[model samples]
Target chain A: MIRGLVRTAFFVAFCAVIGPAYAQGPLQLASDVFVEREIAKPDGTKAKLLEEPKTVVPGDQLVFVVRYKNVGTATASNFVVTNPMPRAVRFDGTADGAELVSVDGGKNWGALATLRIAQSNGGDRAATSADVTHLKWNFNQPLSAGAEGKLIFRGVVR
Target chain B: MDNIFAFRRNNRPARNHRLALGTSLSLLLLTVSAPAFAAGTVAGTDIQNIASATFDSPVGPVTIDSNTVVIKVDELLDVTVVTTDPGDVITNPGQTGNVQAFRITNTGNGDEAFSLVANTANGGDDFDPSLQQIIIDSNNNGVYDAGVDVVYVAGSNEPVVAPDQSKTIFVITSTPAGVANGNRANVSLLASAVTGTGTPGTSFAGQGQGGGDAVVGSTGADAQASSFLAVQSASVTLTKSATIADPFGGQRPVPGAIVTYRLVATVSGAGTLNNLAINDPIPAGSTYQAGSLTLQVAASPATTLTDAADADAGNFNGTRIAVSAGNVPAGETRTVTFRVVIQ
Candidate 1:
């Protein structure tokens, strides 16, 4: 009887310790990165994966919305994103549009200026870091454990 | 030994359960991570594939019509000659030392540059060797040579032939004294291009290189050079003389005897004659009897009659002689006679 009693107490203590750990659940870091086409208000509520626009004639104004959320335990800080400009599109500067960055597919992004000058010297206008046309919003304000933010880009479809 | 065996059996099941749980967790982590890596991956597609609209503006075709350029030669210009000697009269057989002048002119739409070559044969098909050769140098070099070239250089001062523009040229020929009565000769005027045929190159210097020269090669022959011929035949005819006798000799009042004069003129040539005018002026001393001045042949009208009552009477103006014969047909002759007497 005493052995049974002792075994029950040990099991209770094990449950007490392991239950909290198990109940804490997975450190789930999930986010729904959404891109919305800016149409008339009600229709534009539908968001999708970021995609290039079609039928971009010589003159057209376009807007893009990039929404990101952090539904995780830890804050997602110091995050950087890079995107490439389409060949058929020209970049209107950030005053009217978006801030953009480029990494050579994650190779040597720090010395981007020198790398860009070298790339321009190499006759590759598209390879320069300054050639990026993507919207980047550095969440200098951390994404506070389960927060959301958005980046907007207005472009002239040339 | 039993206690040890039982303990080992219990621990084996627990170890299997833990292994199963660990496997499930690993699978869940892999599934979630796999999507994260694939979230923003974009396929590289060409712009042409994603374009939704296209616009084009096509230009229409054009056509141009061809133009015609025609050059024609139209008139049988006259040649005139005068002699100061009384014995040198132009007549049929037995006539002596007469000089004849030919006046040729261009009555066509374009400039008629021609050369005169004499041949005795009636037709251009045959050449007579015994015929005296008269090689007239159009360039006036005073040398009788075969193939001596005469160039009709275009003059800036000369008028361009709009239509029916005329230019006259003359040739004078003398008949030798006591020659055969029926001697005759044919004079032919040959017309040819003075410059190279076909469309002339725009620039004399750069013909072979570019512009139109590359389109039409420099060595290609111009097709516009062509030749035409005109022939005129003149023959000396026998002169017939007859006296008009007064039937009644002795009369109280003898009016001046009236007489009639007749002259026949015939022309035969390679082409048709048009707008032909003949002028015969009476000798200064001869007087025309009243009511005797009249042309017998209406076709060959007398252009001038000094004795005509009206100033313009008997004048042949705008009269044409038509020859219905075939090419190089028999000669056409017409008579024009009027009366005159010595006062």
Candidate 2:
């Protein structure tokens, strides 16, 4: 079972070109990607932050920032954004304060502690940074034309 | 290297060679000696599979799973302790600063730190002696020179025993200020792969970057027993016989008769025969039966064998048999038997 979750690595998705069974409305999903780092404010506060990571070593803190915008003219409802936690890092928690759900390449979603993957020893171990195979964020609000929102989660370089 | 959580015989190469070589069936023998960190090979830790995040968007439950993220895992941890000498033998009133040598190898897939311990046989046959200290052969030379080798202190172990790399270690014992002539001591070197410092309970620390969680093996200990022998004495007796049962139904050998050869080796002496290897070849005019070899000892009933190296008990490849009778304690007996068909 854990191997199933582990295979989530190097995962690739195939897209099916459904010939215009019907003229489906346009939905343009544009995205922006950046790497963020928290910096300290001159006032002795760590409020100031920066982006762009040139190099990173083990046990370093890194935040992934991805912005998604719906550029289509019609409104897009129930837009769910999923960011497969990078293999090199762990999905510790949400840095953007958004409610989140994690999966071990399975259907169940819950707190990281409640999730488990099959251990090699014929037992189940609670999910860890290594166990969390994916992360998801739900935007219940509708996205009108030209509306955009940011989805950000915090992870540590393993 | 076998299934981490599965049951298997524990054939550790500890100080007791004979005992260590005793092989057992994987299912019948389940020794919780190996750490549970190892699993489905190396690449499994870094899952390359992808995740799916779906939500309703009119067309269907669209799962825009994030890009495939192969979770990286830390390096695995493992270690082994061994010695070249068969067994150390010395007379009582042993000299101070007397040293025995050993080597600890990092058997894991990643770099690891090992903490060592040298213990003396608390109390046994005659008496006990004092243990000065255990040292790491920093210079790679076997000899233990005060300044050349660094003394092993509590809480401080080897810095880095790289994967597949070995480091020499020495155990030095000093004769007490005033001691009796007949005294003994058993010293062992233990190597524990240092765990990483992470979510202590959640996952293994001490793992290579992007490696799996940490779980140290039971322990890798190679013992060096220091004896104060009043006299160099050791005697091992081997007695073998063949019993035949064939179409004739009598003890006499016949064309289709199966010959079962049984040999009992008994040791009676103060000194120990560390490696009691039993070698036998198929007799002439007879064809050797494969997988019919086995070892049995009344004292240690649990140690059984099949013919394989990883089996530990002993190994035979039809033509010849090489069984390792680890360390046969005084008054202990080991019995090995095999079957061959008379041509």
The alpha-carbon RMSD values of the candidates against the true structure, listed in the order shown, are: 34.5, 25.1
Residue A105's lDDT within candidate 2 is 48
lDDT of 1: 0.30
lDDT of 2 by residue, B1-343 (tens): 1221121133322111111111111111122121222221231243222323333455443433323222333454456677644565353344567676778876554566777767555555444445787888888876677887898886755557755678888777764434443344555566666563222122353344334444333232122323232323456899998889887788778777899988899987655667899888988888877778888875555344677766576777767777888888768888988888899
- Per-candidate TM-score against the hidden true structure: 0.21, 0.33
What DockQ would candidate 1 receive versus the native complex? 0.01
**CA RMSD (A), model 2:** 25.1
Which consecutive 10 residues in model 2 chain B have the weakest lDDT in total? B14-23
Q: How far off is residue B322 in model 2, in Å?
A: 54
Candidate 1 residues lying further than 4 Å off, grouped into runs, are A1-56, A94-100, A103-130, A133-137, B1-343
lDDT of 2 at B206: 34
Predicted model with the maximum DockQ: 2
A75-102, model 2: which lDDT tens digit per residue?
A: 6677766555545555667755554556
